[model samples]
Target: MIETYLPNVDWTKMWDATVETLYMTAVSTIFTFVIGLALGILLFLTAPGHIWANKLVNLLTGSIVNIFRSIPFIILIILLIPFTKFLIGTIRGPEAAMPALIIGAAPFYGRMVLIALSEIDKGVLEAARSMGAKTSTIIFKVLLPESMPALISGITVTAIALVGYTAMAGIIGAGGLGTLAFLDGFQRNREDVTLVSTVLILVVVFILQFAGDFAVKRLDKR
Candidate 1:
């Protein structure tokens, strides 16, 4: 029955699609982490009683994070069409999809980062400040290092979320396993292809989750 269902399908093409998905997911994850870390640090440092506390900066950053994080991914994708086009000169493909993914995931990661940083011991921060550490020095040396495990977990979560978002990007011509499933299965009514693609995506996500969990466990002091 399975043989009859998926006979002679071009799996090589599907494999290629999977590779593209990985590439897109990886690049977007890196960009999201960098941007989130910066914003998160900014949010933390500017919060009340911190070394660089600035009420207005904190409010603005908090507001932007909340606003962007609240916008649904699909809607954000559609809403960002013009911006995507402006950035990539085309609004349909991995290139176009990347900016959207970065925008959607970065602020979310920022909040996660802020939460992680805030979880650190306040006394530790005070000690770092008393040692004549600059704001940048404290963030890099004290907050980030102390919160490494939590940050790792956050990255793992963000990576998994990006996988889901990339699947949705299929609707906009972004080539990935999602596109394969949509084009070969949903649109064409090929259940075998759809099932296979679904399984592949699940496997990929599970692997990412496992790897992330392992890293978090290894890094975590608690």
Candidate 2:
């Protein structure tokens, strides 16, 4: 009777895999935003005419962000193998995948942040400077607050991208729905497992979009 309903998926294993996938996605997303936000602010401040502007710093930092963002995630996983092992004592689990995801997604998200920040009006910034606002004051009070809507949207997009990255991370033995679907389902020809995993991933994407858009609406004063 139970077999008739759950044919291939062991409920316990499926739940555990779901938890692992969410864990990887949550941890990586938080760190990626933290890193990306800082880097984005730095990039904006260093661009020509901004308070902290420095030609060499902006050039070097922008180049580094571009270099990392340009690499494909699969290649990034392989490249970060040694670093992952060093940080987490092994590179074949969800935890190990965290560093790789953070490194790869952070800069990609950072670029998004830079674009959002750049869209703010120069007049507002000039007004702030004329008012004798400190650099930190302008960033925290003027820039971040004004740009929250765009930042939230950028974060939503980046989070969606990270979901796909987590699946690819499963290729390196990172345990998640992706690992279950790819290794167990594909290898054993278990269509039920594959289908269930795909559906769950889709559901996750939908939830992220809904939650992100909801937040954006609440914060969007205009």
Best by TM-score: 2
Q: Any runs in candidate 2 off by more than 4 Å, and if so which?
A: none
In terms of lDDT, the poorest run of 10 residues in model 1 is: 1-10
Number of colliding residue pairs in each model: 0, 0
Residues 165-202 of candidate 2 have per-residue lDDT tens digits of 99889877999989988998888999889888888888
C-alpha TM-scores of all predictions: 0.96, 0.97
What are the lDDT figures for the candidates, one per model?
0.91, 0.91
lDDT for 54 in candidate 2 is 100
RMSD of each: 1.3, 1.2
Give per-residue CA lDDT, model 1, range 91-207, as digits (tens).
877878999999999999999999999999999988987899887788788899899999999999999999999999987889898898898778988877888888989998999
lDDT of 1 at 144: 91
TM-score of 2: 0.97
Per-residue lDDT, model 2, residue 10, is 84
State the displacement of the C-alpha of residue 44, model 2, in Å, after optimal TM-score superposition. Answer: 0.6
